[model samples]
Target: MNDSHSAELLRYAAFTADPAGGNPAGVVLDATGLDAADQLAVAADLGYSETAFLTPAAAGGRAFAVRYFSPRAEVPFCGHATVAAAVALAERIGAGELLFETKAGPVPVLVEAGPDGVLAATLTSVEPHVEPVAAADLTEALAALGWSDGELDPAFPPRVAYAGARHLVLAAATRARLAELSYDFERLAALMTRLDLTTLQLVYRESEHVFHVRDPFPVGGVVEDPATGAAAAALGAYLREVHGVQEAELTLHQGEDLGRPGVLRVELRAGDPRIRVSGTAVPIGPRRG
Candidate 1:
């Protein structure tokens, strides 16, 4: 609306309506003149897990070119930031369809008001695929995480999955094992950097359709991400590959252990390579003060 408002970075907690919950993200609705260094500086100053910088696409209205940056580095894709940006746009221009030209690929987002009147955004990820993890690498990952090989669930196995961004998918045998997340930060960060991973998707299946998940995001300069949309999309594709599921709706509960509870809804449609991750976001208090 105003030049002053568009110039300031907007802060929102994605995947939940509560400002204190979910993964906080910085949304620069109009980063038209900001350079790479400027974007990085803004993200680092905000100190969130990640931030979204958007410029109106040359193609037309309702389309934008978006880039995601973590506190330390720029990422190819970021789910929570996308959620935050889409909702932010919807709030101003009415909820419906939006397109983002991302480094990973072109992503489509749908924003609509939920039953409770809060806006929710659904993002369809890029084509996703899964690859087997090498035995030595798996052992090294477990060591960095302070977890033993036996703690892993045999059913889920180990894999490097990619949706919008790459993530290492590791399923713990028990919920307790997943909760006690004390990892070697530097070691894990090195491993993630070498693998070009955005985060480690640590998961435990609560039921056939419900799961509890956490993300170790050392690369982002954050201990953990309360809700990880990219990881969720990767996990959804991983499940489809491992279990041969055609279509399903699964609920991922995250951030509860950290007292910032968040819910991410993952959907897989038969014959569709892209996974859809949906959640709500709420604006936080005055930012960059």
Candidate 2:
């Protein structure tokens, strides 16, 4: 297919209303002809952490089949990409409910226009689960991150959490511990490759409902992610499972150290296992020729 008929590419910064903040993502409104290699090439050219490709499914249904690609490879699911796609669609087709058939599962997204006419998107993930981290793995990860066992928070132990993709959740004892993020990238990338991890979800709980987080995304060919929606969902699930947090709402502050501050909102229901991640997105600008 020719480029003209394939799809319209839109760029947006997700998880933050400001274009200067949050993670940027490329959204293909109708990727009916692009193959996997083409998608990868597009993602590589865009140079975003990840990009979303959307195609209409069989029948006249509104639900779409979505695929996510990083510069290096395809991921099972991507939260920021989903948010970007939702907002892009809303801008063109009007705000409403949308469904995405992803490699992990069906993700439901809600889109609306804010008071200032900015688009906001929210996605409810598939059932989330948490698993205990092996001691040896934790030790190796800590070593790679230059973090000692004593620096970890006793209340929040390390664990592997999954909303769509697996992430290692490590809580810091202090915010300073979270900010000092120099690490051996190659070593952490190798370890993440061995364990099939996407990113390391490092967090510091500021209060019962507020937290600060950073994501080391070595596996995605990026040193760090300014805003990570998938990891935020996984963290919400982990908190609910380990701490029995019955609260329905939580907030995450991220990307401050990177100078790109983004906020992610996580919602948990008492009976539902799915976690909801919400944020606003704004256009980055026109696509490159």
- TM-score of each prediction: 0.97, 0.96
- The deviation in Å at residue 5 for candidate 2 is 11
lDDT of each: 0.93, 0.91
Among the numbered candidates, top lDDT falls to 1
- After superposition, the stretches of candidate 2 with alpha carbons farther than 4 Å from their true spots are 1-7
The per-residue C-alpha lDDT of model 2 at residue 67 equals 95
lDDT of 1: 0.93
Residue-wise C-alpha lDDT for candidate 2, range 1-289, written one tens digit per residue? 3353255678899998898999999899788888888888888888889999999866346688999998888999999999999998888788999999999999999998889888888999989999998999999999999999999999999999999999999999999999999999999999999998999999999998999999998877888999999999999899998999866799999999999999999999888889999999989977643
Predicted candidate 1 versus true structure: per-residue lDDT over 1-289, tens digit per residue: 2232335799999999999999899999889878877888788888999999999998888999999999899999999999999999999999999999999999999999989999999999999999998888888899999999899998998999999899999999999999999999999999999999999999999999899999999998999999999999999999999888779999999999899999999999999989999999999998552
What C-alpha lDDT, on a 0 to 100 scale, does residue 269 get in candidate 1? Answer: 99
Clashing residue pairs in candidate 2, if any? none
